[model samples]
Target: MEALRAEHLDKRYGADETEVWALRDIGLVLRAGEIVALLGPSGAGKSTLIKVLGLVTRADHGDLWMNGERVLDDGAPVADVGELRRSHLGFVFQKANLIPFLSARQNVEIACEIGERFAPRARADELLDYLGVGHRGDALPNTLSGGEQQRVAIARALANAPSLILADEPTAALDKERGRAVMELFRRVAHEQGTAVRVVTHDHR
Candidate 1:
């Protein structure tokens, strides 16, 4: 199934003399059960593309569809962006970004709650277990190893069973081994759970 599609996307910053076209005529399609890596150097508009596709930033011009529904048109939103995001999209960043005070399970639980899933706590635990982080569920983020923290973040991202996940430099902070593991984890999640994943990174390996 097509999880996401965007065509003729354009994004610009500033006006007149200082104007910069961050992205122009960019197009993309993502299907379920696929893991796509957006590899580029710095200032290549990779993150801009992610932000646009994730709906965190509007494209100056484009048409965007998710799950066969048209959500954006000509830089404007046709649907409730917030509701669509909560229901269909997940995100991971360079850092784990888990709340400091919340335990691993609670971090995932809050996401489940936001996604309005039933039995949030149970769902959180299930995801943690599925991601191989159940044993660390009660541990704080700071206490967990880097790889473990990233696993928890991935579990939280899966809490809503989202159709698409957008990860921006998700492994940039990890060591080589842990980074590869996280990339492999994304592949597993995409294939096994039928989620579409887009990861932005400088790593070409």
Candidate 2:
């Protein structure tokens, strides 16, 4: 099933002499159970594409569809963006960005609460276990290793069973081995859970 589709996406910053086109005529399709890596150097608009597809930023012009439903047209939202995001979208970032005061499990549980899932605590525990971080669920973010932190982040992203996940440089802070492990985790999550994933990275490996 098609998880997301974007056509003729154009994004520009500023105007006139200082105008910069962040994205121009970009098109993309992501299917359920598929993982796509977007590679580019800094300033290549890779993050811009992610922001657009994730619905965090509006394109100057384009159409967007999620799960075969039209969500945006010509840079305008046709649906309730917040509802769509809460129901179908998930995001991970370079920093684990877990709440400093919350345990790994609480971090995930909070996301479940936001999505209005039943039994947030159980769902959080289940996702942590699935992500191989069950043992660390009670640990605070600062006490966890970088890799473990990312694992918790991933679990939080999956709390609501989103159809699509957007990750931006999720492993940039980790060593090669840890980075590869996180990437592999994403692939596993995509295949096993039938979630579409798009990862932005500078690494070509």
Candidate 3:
């Protein structure tokens, strides 16, 4: 089944003269249990596309169907983006951005607690264990390594069991080995959790 489907998506900024086309008639379909990476140079609208698809930002034109529902249509909003983002989508950025005071498990559990997801801390520890970070459940973000921090971030993204996971430059901060590990973890989560993963990166490296 397709987890996300975007059709003829177009987005622009500013008025006619100063307008900039961020995305132009872009179309994409992501199947369940698939891990796809988006590669492009700076100013290529990669981040813009992720934001629109993730429902963090609205698309100026086109439609986005998540799990077969029309959330966005013809540059207009049809559903509550905030609610949709919370219930059906997950996101990760360049940094882990964990709460300084919160431990690993707490950081992961916080998302599930706020969202409608059933599991909270239990799910967090489970995911952290699966991601190979269970040993650091009580460790603060400052105490964890870079890889561990990203792993915690990934676990947090999966806390809600979202059908679609969108990440922006997720592995940018890690070295080659750690970066590949993070990418592979995304694949594992997509396949194991039956979620669709879409990542935006400047380089496949």
Best by lDDT: 2
lDDT of 1 by residue, 63-163 (tens): 99999999998889999999988989999999999999999999999999998865798998888998888999999999999899999999988989999
TM-score of each: 0.98, 0.98, 0.96
List model 3 lDDT by residue over 1-205, tens digit each.
8899999998898988999999999999999999999999999999999998988777878988888888887868888878888888889999999999999999989998989566787888898999999999999999999999999999899888899999999999999999999998998998888999999999667
The lDDT of model 1 is: 0.92
- The clash numbers for all candidates, in the given order, read 0, 0, 0
TM-score of 3: 0.96
Each model's lDDT comes to 0.92, 0.93, 0.91
Q: Flag the better candidate by lDDT, 2 or 3.
A: 2
Q: Quote the lDDT for 123 in model 1.
A: 95
Candidate 1 residue 65 C-alpha distance from true site, Å: 0.3
RMSD to true structure for each model, in Å: 0.9, 0.8, 1.2
Candidate 1 similarity to native, TM-score: 0.98
Model 2 misplaced stretches (Cα beyond 4 Å)? none
